[model samples]
Target: MIARFDYIAAVILFSIGLYALVVKPNLIKKLIGLNIIETSVYLFLIASGDVRLGIYTNQWAASNVIDNPQRAVQGLEPMINPIPSALVLTAIVVSVCVTAIALSVVVKLYQHYGTLDAREIASLKG
Candidate 1:
């Protein structure tokens, strides 16, 4: 039951984010909703990469060596795939950049219209 909590939390967060995005009229709230969705995705990805019972292999130098074929087979403990974790790290950086750009755009929009509501801004633009 405890193991399924991460997925449940992800679902809940995703739904909340979706709801906020669909129901909110404020541009800033919509941006926050997008951030929430991104966070939920990151949580799901990190959960997928989790290995509670796996052995930690810290072979940085050995990874470069092509001669040691036996090293790969020597581990009896299941090794967690490192690619997802690495990808998640990259995603985090990208998410931050996206959020910053989004916030900057929102700032510009607010400056131009003097309002944060999406409906109001649209009406003002027309």
Candidate 2:
């Protein structure tokens, strides 16, 4: 439980965001919730990629080869995975673009309907 605190926090954040996205009637609130969900996903990905007490690849190699020659011949050293972090970075950029588009749509909707409430906009349309 203690070791997996990040996972727990991510779950909680996701739940809160999901609640806001589903239960809120305001479009802006929904966008905020969506952002929260994205953030939680980012946190989860980063945490999943983390290596406890692990050294960087270069540092590990240098330390083994230079500081401890015998350790170099033993095997590969523990290092944090880079793939998840890289994927998260890509997701963040995509998320920003998506948020920008969503906000623009929301702005248009507000301008047309004079309100940001989803129900109000629907009623106005009908």
Candidate 3:
């Protein structure tokens, strides 16, 4: 359970974000929730990609294991997985772009409707 603490925290964060996204009536609050959700996903991906190397895969090594040639030769030495990190980086860029676009739209909406409340905007729509 302790070993999987990060996963647990990520789940909790995701739940909080989901609740905020669903229940908030303010556009800005919803955007903040979306950002929180994205952050939880990032945390999950980073935690999942973590590889602990030592006597046991779950146990942390007391010393640096990257220099162990024998383990490397046997394909047992723990190495960093770049795929998740790369994906997270790409996702962050995409998230930023999406958030920027959404914020711009919100600004336009506020200018047109003179309000940022979703319910008000919906009711005012023709």
Preferred candidate (lDDT higher): 2 or 3: 3
Instruction: Sum up the clashes in candidate 3.
Output: 0
lDDT of 1 by residue, 69-98 (tens): 465457633445678788888998998999
Q: Put down candidate 2 lDDT per residue, 11-48, tens digits, no spaces.
A: 99999999999999999999999999999999999999
lDDT of 2: 0.84
**Ranking according to lDDT, highest score first:** 3, 2, 1
For model 3, what is the alpha-carbon lDDT of residue 124? 93
What is the Cα-based lDDT of residue 21 in candidate 2?
A: 99
Give the number of the best model, judged by lDDT.
3
Deviation from native of the Cα of residue 113 in model 2, angstroms: 0.5
Candidate 1 runs further than 4 Å off: 54-73
Candidate 1 contains a number of clashing pairs equal to 0
Cα miss at 34, model 3 (Å)? 0.3
lDDT of 3 by residue, 31-68 (tens): 99999999999999988888755636444576455678
Q: Kindly give the stretch of ten consecutive residues in candidate 2 with the minimal lDDT sum.
A: 60-69
Please list the residue runs of candidate 3 whose C-alpha ends up more than 4 Å from where it truly belongs after superposition: 53-60, 65-76
Residue pairs that clash (backbone atoms under 3 angstroms), model 1: none
